[model samples]
Target: MAKSPFRWIGRLTKPVLIACVIGFFSAFGLADRIAGFSANLGEKDRMVRWSAVLSGATRDAIPVTLIDIDPSTMAALGHPQSAPREVLAGLLSLAAAKHASGIFLDMDTSRPGSPAGDAALAAVLAAYPPDAPPLALARRLGAADQAGNTINALAEQASVLDAAVRGKPNVIWAASVSRIDEDRVVRRWQLSHTTCAPGPGATLPSPQLFAAAVASAHPRPLSDLNAFADSRTQTACAPGTAAASPPAWPRNPDQRAAIAFLIPDGPDLAAPQFITRDGRRVPLFRRMPARALMSASGAVVSPQAVADDLLRDRFVIIGASHAESLDGHLTPIGFLPGALIVANAVATAPAVLSGQPVGPLGATLIALALLGALVAITSRLRPLAAALAVAVAVLAALMALGRIFAPSTASDIVLAALGMVAFLSTIEGIHAIGKDWRARGWRALLKPEKPPAAQPTETIT
Candidate 1:
């Protein structure tokens, strides 16, 4: 029984072909269509989020906000000529008044400094106090002293972190865990991680180090604290993958397990709330008024938001989420909104408290879905149809998720819309460039005559 030649061509269409290829790559985590993830929440309808939190849109219900240094701040900071340190210090002070959960210094302090400027900022940080503190402050409990709060003392001791408050014990630093992608984009970033100390004990990334520094500020004696995650896990990851390093353990037993204990948990993890800095609100992407951010003196606030949150017992993560600034990462659904990073962090904090990780598999699945969907659209469907399908799928998926979970749909919607556009463009590009070379050749057979090439000299000679 011989098969018919035409049977070979039974099922070939743009959609199916592309979808198959896309699905295969997605399953393997190698979709290469997207440019990369972004951290910009300045775009309309986006929120920021970061990791150390659990799952994706499913867990997006959590609330963390972007204390943006927007145009308003820019104006207050004095454009290009004036000093920015004063402005930053003022913002910190203002947020403190608003009772912000905690302030994470998302900005890089390594840069932007002069002796005078650094001293000014350090003085401000030293003034604030922490909810809890080291023995130094603890010893000073009954004894009166003309110094800042416990937060200020600890922040001051965090000289490696930059500068500090002189007598305060509650200040802390915050940094990001940036990850690179195939496309050379900083798509996914981690708020914390475990790493080798490196030769000569090179320091860990800022986020983890800063977190460690903050966790150490507490009065809990190291002897009573149970630290973990520093030990190497015996388990091996999958083939070609690097082994998972253990996370840093805090000296405080409760915090040795997680940072949630660093401060008391107050608001519902998912409540949509933002800290109103200095009783003034900034446009989501813009900044608030100068007067609102400033103290009667040239200084910003009487006390930083750090003092307020810690003194009041709150959770804070002072980190930046500026996408145009390339200060963001790729998340499960795609790249996360900067605002969403804060949300993800707060959401994941519970898991850390409970010792329940959302599992790498969940994030893996999201990346796979995005990659697969893109390849499918780009390879198979018509440009217009693929685009429409992608948009619809993204919207439907986000809406569906949002209906049950809080804002869990943002990533899905964003990725889907992007993939749809990509796939459509790729398909159109392929078609527009021309295809079916075999068919074109076949048409040549119907030509009247061939333009003959010169023949070799006759061998008969």
Candidate 2:
């Protein structure tokens, strides 16, 4: 007998119902909450860590260098709470002399230092040549008040240093902050921070971002960098000229980008190594001892040839790596120095600018497609086989998503996997209930068999 055309609709009813339910959850953000829970459990971090491991170290030459202030350097410099201003000035002078492309001093200069040291640092800043590479000094912001106003004590700088570079176009005060996740792992780098100030408001870019902005080969304007900041909020801080109060500092919702770690933390700093996926050795960033750059008298210690090769035309970041410095944070690979984190961020800057391989909408679509495909493929298998299929599909999706999108959309992949599992289980449950109902002849309550469709009785007496 010819089948009814409407039978196809009956066949599609269950799948359509499942799709609608999944779509509802996704649209209303329940899926996001599920993803958040997964992230809080470290699933997202694991995906990111594996992604970095599988992708391997960057092939291109690293354009950044770290001047590490390790224990030895700190002991040599008297282990002050802060790196001495004089020592920093000497390092700056050495880098400038070697034609470094840009320099970021990651040490906090929020308080006063010895008078002589301050004077020496100020002199170096004032004497910086017009043609010298741009300099970025780390500026720390005080805790925000109830109204979101922060106190940026200009006193954080040695009074002398502040005076020398107050209005210098080449000198920039950039924010040096990292976003530490709830698990205490530092996975993201906040690009810029805009806050209300007592005088004119201020905007500060992270050191990594500032380095990217002032890159010598292809310098980008400060305005260009704004595109990377949190687009949901106003990134521009208006001047407080009119006696009216400035707007409250907007919450930085999307200012941060996931850091793509190129090198894992090494146990041996003396002989650090990084091997890529293809078994090739690569350096993510060059590291040098701060002491190698200058002496107690602020005279260059390393030979000109060595210094030139190390510093010339490179973005240099000077930060402490000593254990006592308490500047280390947990990362995907392991506990690493904050300087290394900054270096990784600098390495990952290009990727951040390139953006996620797929955006939220695209990711959602991909996830839904993956779910639909999983459901279609697994429905025909035995229960155990179906479970295994689901597992394999979820694993494959996660790996691919992590490799292409990194941590930015890892949570979505996880959420999709979870939804698929729930969906399959619900389908199975419904089928089981239907089977039991028919076995017990309980289907009569819903819809009677209609006496076998009233089959004609052609039998004669």
Candidate 3:
């Protein structure tokens, strides 16, 4: 009897269908979490260039600036963890004089230092004119969530500077924290202090917000700070909508804002030019050594020049950027200083407002479509051939998409394709097993052993 044409397909159907269902569910469930991790996998160098290229690498400088308390400054000052409070005060004083839009110190002033230094810094902080840019000092916040906490209680949760500096009205305290992923990479920026329970007359602002507060400072009040605090939008802004308004603050204190990193245009980061891994040119904000803020004689550098080059109307972030600071992190663009991380977060505000980061919906749909095509193709082609073809096509597609979309979304698509591959491969293995079993049975049934045995016995008799 001839075998039914549908027999082979029937054998493959159950396993294939079962695998597809599992694949779909798993892809939807874990793709966003696990697959999105270790983005470059071990290809940090290449991925860095790729990430920069996709971020629309540019040659123009951004408005932000980095005043790093880097190695050079450290060598001059003879301290590791702290820069002279007097020096910091001098920097701030100069920034104020230059008409800076915002000045943020990514330093921990939680403890009191030299009294004179502290007093000088405090004096500078208090002396800023109403028209001058705001100065925000970074403070570390405790991990305990304050979701239902009281006013006084929430205040206690903040690990702020000593009473002297923390008491100033001109200085805003922005929490400096990064939502680190399992891979130890910072992919999200927490915008609210929701975790620190809500209380009356108490608000928690992120360091990013403090920096922005300075950038957005004008003679006129924008609105009650609290009103805008919890209303940040995570979705991309609509077309032609002005990003002019201060960035939306998330209502959920734990909400994480997506970070769209700027690409590097050069290898020697300290140099003026930035370069992507692919040799493409990109622009970055002006970065002056923290040493530049002061002269070799420990005097403040050209206040006017500093103002024109870095401070005037530009958002300034001061932090430790050199390697010894140990603040470097693994980014899509390889290891970078924490200063750049803050800069990236600040820069992301405009990008998000401009709707540059594509959402996951479109990428998810594309992933699903590709998965379905893989399933259909595997059903018809030789199993091995199908696997190879699908893998090649999917990887290529993902690479192309990674160039256009964010890494997070690209990961989702790749993850979905991987799930489909697992499903299809399993079904093929089962079909092959059944095919071999049937082949063996047919060979046995068609064997001529019995006739041969009978003839041998008769001849012997």
Candidate 4:
């Protein structure tokens, strides 16, 4: 073959050899576009964030609030046997009387009336009216039967309950999204708050939303409390003789309620300690102990603080804090105390309630700039050394950013981390590919392939 003079040049230059790898990622839409890079990087960063956030066994700042019971408690309580309905009622009543700013009920009534096991739970829930603002079912029980009868029955109960709690206090429901990225970590909390019915009536709403509606429903300005009346409609979520099932309650000016917040709760959590009595301490996630007291008993927070905040017209979300009940969250520093999250809920309610938004792009650009400098400096170093430097830098950046982002409750951390990861991975992948390509070319040119005729010549000899 003609002397492949350019072959040696390709081997030494390295750029030509790495072009295939570069082109491969680019063609796959991974390394080529900013959006793609941002997304992939964002996802990986989310994983790392979760790891770092949940690394220690410490509790999360967000409380692992338990509003419902699980199988273990059920077994302990001697089920098939139920916790006295009165106990359930008393606890809720206590919370409301204590000026507990808000309450969220996390439970499912999906199979109500379907079987003996489900019917008892349904009755206890139906006893509370939706208008009372003391409770909100996290969700209607999903369809358990082929005919969807179970779902229909639960929907009716929810509707009936919704009517009773129309505008009392902030009694919100909870919802969650099931989707996740390449990693199982839930990056987004898709308001798991929605419902459909196959029965005469169906209804559903988040406890937070209900509670906000109640708070937001207080029509008067902060100063003119005496003149304030609920401007919110009193329309019940129950069926109104519509040919098809009527829509759920708080439906006005659109289906949206007055309250909505984008804060997320981790699904990667342990079950909560659903408190039925006043004195029992609720357990937190990971079987951690958290005291759960009837809000009325004033066992949890200082009365002075509670009174002051109540007077200031702040909302309070009082739920049991137990590890077994998982009333805690995994925060960056460690497990944050649940009490702090409750305080944040009230302290920043105005911003969250008002729907303040922070831009991800701004965060991304800033992070990228910082990372770019770091990458540039590290790029010249050996791979291991560079990796270590980048890792340290990332940790420092995360701690600083955690402080900045916490107050605003923004998604900036994920976006920023993603930006950093993307740039670094791209550069590293490219360099490795280039080196590999260069090595291959060097081997090809330095030790040319034996002439094909040599094989035939050996046979002839």
On TM-score, the leading prediction is 2
lDDT tens string, model 4, 287-311? Answer: 2111233234323333343332222
Instruction: Candidate 1: list runs displaced more than 4 Å.
Output: 1-62, 81-83, 97-99, 132-173, 184-187, 191-292, 295-461
**Candidate 1 lDDT tens digits, 315-432:** 2333333333344455433454343344334433322322223333553565466657666755667868875775565555554433332232234334544555557668866564
Q: How far is candidate 3 from the true structure (C-alpha RMSD, Å)?
A: 12.8
lDDT of 1: 0.39
**TM-score of every prediction relative to native:** 0.40, 0.66, 0.61, 0.44
Worst 10 residues of 1 by lDDT: 135-144
RMSD of each: 16.6, 12.5, 12.8, 14.9
Sort the candidates on TM-score, descending order: 2, 3, 4, 1
Preferred candidate (TM-score higher): 2 or 3: 2
The digit string of per-residue lDDT tens for model 2 on 181-274 reads 8888898888777664554445677887677666523566544444444231243444332333322222112366677776555536435533
Best by lDDT: 2
Cα lDDT tens digits, model 3, 1-461, are 45598879987999999899778868789645555554544353344444333443221223577777777888877755667778877777777777766777877665677777778776776565665666677765543344344434323243324454554556666666677888987767766453323432334566565554345322223243444553332122232444445434321122465455663423465344443312334334667677877777776776755546456656777777655667777765556787778887664343222222444576567767887777776777885898688757655765566555544345456666666667867887666666766657655334234552233334564
Residue 228 displacement (Å), model 1: 4.6
TM-score quality measure for candidate 2: 0.66
Ranking by lDDT: 2, 3, 1, 4
Cα lDDT for residue 276, candidate 4: 18
